[model samples]
Target chain A: MEKGILETLVGVLARPTSTIRSICQQRPIGWAIIVYLVASLVSTIVWIETGFYDLEGMGLPDVGMPTIIVGSIIFNIVILVVFTALSHLAASLLGGKGGYGGLFSSFGFASLPGIFVAPLAVVGMLPMVGALLSGLGNFGVLIWSLALYILAVRENYLVSTGRAILILLLPTVVLLVLSGLLVGLLLLSV
Target chain B: MSRSKIIALIIGVVIVVSLIVLFFGQEIVPPHPRVAIITLTGPIQGSDGGLPFPDTAITPELVRGLLEQAEGDRSIKAVVLRIDSPGGMIAASQEIGDMIKEFEKPIVVSMGDQVTSGGYYISAHADMIIAQAGTITGSIGVIFTHLNVDGLLEKLGIEMETVTGGEHKDMFVTPLTPERRYLIQRITDAAHDQFIHTVAEGRDLPISEVRELATGELFIGRQALELGLVDRLGGRQVAINVAAELAGIQEWVVIELAPPVPSLFDLFLGGGSILREMAIARLLGDEITLLRTLLKTYSLPRY
Candidate 1:
């Protein structure tokens, strides 16, 4: 039977290990995408409305509302796909067995914690300690998301916690090295 | 209940508690007395998106909108007009000045380093004008410049042909004709007359007296105070105090109003990519300032 979205969301935070295991097995890519997109949409709207991104002093150009919304969604989708691809590759390299559907669903569900923090973005607009609360709330959301990501890795591939962490760190390490090399090359050419 | 369910229930409870503490907590807070500060930085130009460059300068529409917001808000006891500009076009200055004059709430003008020409024109009608001791202000006059770049084109060995609907259509080309110059002078004089007349009425000085002092001369805050052009010589805090006194309020909270909702261009092209980083900065107030400094230090200069 398909799990209730709320029940699954609650499960993800409460019992992440089993929640991710069931999500991988069920391969509910559609539901995962919906949850991720809805959460992202709410957070992005709050981000714009609250003037968190409205620092004119930074001289960043503001695009249209539609563009921001559409561009952000497109970017989120792209990031999701890219992260899935990287994770799949890492899993295969590490000799862990997991299908693309399972990996995608598990990763998608991993983003649920981001939704809980969406309201915090709006709440953080309050005066006084609003900014600090917002920071802490965002930090909490990130930690939750990271934990979910690790659980997704471990359960989907049946890997140990240490191996799951290694798999998760692979993409970031690769990106940093590649960027550093590109920068070094440009500097050398100059 | 199983361990998983128990853990789930605990997590749910924590999330609920956080929501109450962080979200609803703001609503439970009491409102305080606030003095809204509307900043008018850069030149007071006409409008946006007309020229090759973007119109990042303060415009009449922006000023008018801010004045209306300040006027409508009861929480806002008084408004502070923080102006730092060398001035802009004539029509924009007049529109903004009229709006400020029409504002029912008490307003105090806080002049920055450069408040001259149109800047002075707008603030002259405010309830109180405060400037720093060394602030440049009171560039009381009007001017119109017509570029005669025909010689430069000739030096570059470039000849331009033109078609015109009327005789004076090509009048603005290099080497301004005598009739065109006379017409331009008349236009400048008319604008000058309007400026002095408004100043005289606003300052309660005679038209002749204003005209005598309005010779396109720049003055420091001390000189402006002596000449009765500006009411006081001080900075932003003093302006706030005066505004509080004028509004008959003993205690007040000073809050700088956010600039008008950023243009869409700002949303997408400008600050969009840095949304994540900016969110982090917004959460950590001081980090935003630090991030801005870091961005400025490393980012390539724009022309």
Candidate 2:
């Protein structure tokens, strides 16, 4: 019998090495991408609806319905595609054997943790400990997803754990520094 | 079951729970019988939020939005309009009054310190009116006032220039020309007739009796009741009880409709609005000056 999608997801979370190996071998990139995209969209709509972004220091307002839908789709697609592409590039540079398609499948499946993390981010928007909880929860999800992604990368490329981590962190660190610079410029101009 | 099968079930539960939360995020609570209270305490004008600053008054758009909300909510059995104002723009008053008249739910007007002129105009069409004994109401006519300042300009050695497409366009200039006075009276009389008819039909009183009371005379709540301008002399609680009885609801939650909270940007914008209000207050100097300015700003000419 074929494993159900839920079974595959549970496998991806609990047994990342074997799950990434199977996912890469099967190469079901389309289904994996759709799952990631849909989860991202739903979580985005929840974040907007719950007024989660109405916290201090963000300088963003409570976005409306149309903005939520359009912005979520654009932000999710761009971020997901860009991050997947960057991982593929990093793996290629590191002399890994996997193609862009396999890396995409591995990373998309790796985003399964977001489904659980999104609600926690929402809960963090509550009154007293809201900002701290939201930050901690999101940070926890990031660390968890990073761990899963490292395993997926390692399995997909037949690379060592150290190599997989290097592949993942290179693009992420560059993007963070670039975005920080951009934000700093904007603040100075303002 | 196997370990993978158990994990699959757990993941299924998580997915279902998350989906449920996302879909029903906005309206988590169920509905119940409610009476919406919309308080109008200042000059009624256009919709809220075209201005940079905050407004404490009822706008035409605000009242209509609240009415629409009450209408759509299955839990809302009735509406209570808590009104306290000397008067405001005729167009705004009529707009709000028309909405109140068209509403299917029972509405009771609770008059506070003062609900006269355009304020009365809006509330007259309600199912019932309740006023406090000390309330000043029943100013049923319209007035148009303007600043002449012709003598002041002349004394200051400033010659006033005028340009107009129509001969009557400059009627707002001081020295109170006879033609301008006649025009003003004609406009006020037409508006007065409309007011009288609305009050007469709404209160089920005769046209003649309404015309007698529509002489721009402000009356105390007790006097107004004696003259049939008001239904009862009581406060907000009595109005709420009467509204509940009319809507066939014994007990209901009260929903007060206020304007939405302003954005963070509004805190900065509020400064400009305060300066504008201060300028107007300075020009006002006293009650009569304030009244004159209000009439100039908000009075709508029927012509």
Candidate 3:
């Protein structure tokens, strides 16, 4: 009983379970990352082609719907396939179970917390209170990331803290670099 | 702590600070001359459906009241127009802009989280305008929005009632007549010209320079400063300090404008979102001034 109590205490001390459901329950994180990325790409294409971003600028290209759709699909497909493969490799290394679904689930879950950015940025602009809240808001994101790490620990597929940290860092750098390269290529091609 | 209790603690601290400032903080400083804090909130004009969303506009009446207060009061060393709006209708925007120009006193505009088109219009001529570095501003442009309510009306088989010498007299109602589009364009151009003109004059930028910003784009405070839209980049406390310094007041009081009434959330759930609470009370019974909000929103596509 005492041992059970101690283990329970440790679990609680480890921080509350993410309550985000089982890691693989929703869209597999790996595929979800691809989906999220693809959606983002599509949204950007729509924004540009629809002249959404150009609303502020006096003039912008008269890019048609066909170009926008084709561009978005092509970009997203490339992104999805690439990230899917990488996530698979990561999963294999971590001794993760299953194929596409498991890898996708982990990838998807890792980035879920970023959705809070929209609301956080919006709310952060308030005056005296806003100044105070936005200062605190960045911490919530950090906590969310830590919570994901905990979730990973909770599942049998645990990493050495250093390996886990590296896993997080490498993928983020990969995405950023990819996005930057794509943006540059798009701009240059245009 | 449980989330509720943690939230409660935060509330308690904010309230304590606010109260202490309200009641006793002024005694320590030397007598700083008084700065007028004209209460400006809610829809700008008469409250008969005058906004895209009352729950989200800085009303005409509020602007009018502020102007009136400034004109009437003499003890007011200077006026600090604290604006917290995400922009609103062209009419309201213009009216408020006119009021600011008419005001005789030295005024300083202090933008909160969001002081966009209409809000910026009201404070453009202040001796200075201060905004937080992350504060969303600019959106120095104009637009007209029309929702396709014709389908809903058709579904309900709601027939229109009209008696007009001109066919397009009710130019704004939707299923927007082709003639109405022309009229709207004229209106948009006029408002746009005025917006560009005011920003140009206020920021001392060339008309062409201002036109660059007139793309109806939104900006962070830093960007706004770079664009010459805002005079300073800081939040309310900085605005307050600047106002005090400008007014030559050594020991003065700083009071926030109270909401006209409690927000729906405040009425029921209570706590959280002082902004939303203020928004709910002031904006209820207002129309959705969608042109500015839509324009501003579309302008900020992140890619």
DockQ (Cα-based) for each candidate: 0.12, 0.13, 0.01
Per-residue lDDT of candidate 2, residues B38-134 (tens digit): 8877766554423333345667766776788679766689989999877777777888889989999999999999998888888889999999889
Task: Report the TM-score measured on chain A for model 1.
Answer: 0.90
How displaced is residue A9 in candidate 3, in Å?
A: 71
lDDT of 1: 0.75
TM-score of each: 0.69, 0.60, 0.44
Ranking by DockQ: 2, 1, 3
Residue-level lDDT of model 2, residues A131-151, one tens digit each, is 578778778878888898898
Q: Please, what are the lDDT tens digits per residue for candidate 1 over residues A1-190?
A: 2767667877777778888999989999998888788667766666665545453433456576778889889999899999888988998899889888888888888887775665575456455676689889889989988888888888888999999999989987998999999757743542
Off by over 4 Å in 1: A1-8, A15-18, A25-38, A41-45, A48-82, A90-96, A118-127, A158-190, B1-38, B47-56, B61-79, B102-106, B160-167, B174-179, B243-303
Give stretches of model 3 more than 4 Å off: A1-190, B1-32, B38-57, B161-163, B177-179, B256-303
Q: Given candidate 1, what's the lDDT at residue A128?
A: 62
What's the true lDDT of residue B264 in model 3?
42
Give the least accurate 10-residue stretch of model 1 chain B, judged by summed lDDT.
Answer: B294-303
Ranked by TM-score, top first: 1, 2, 3
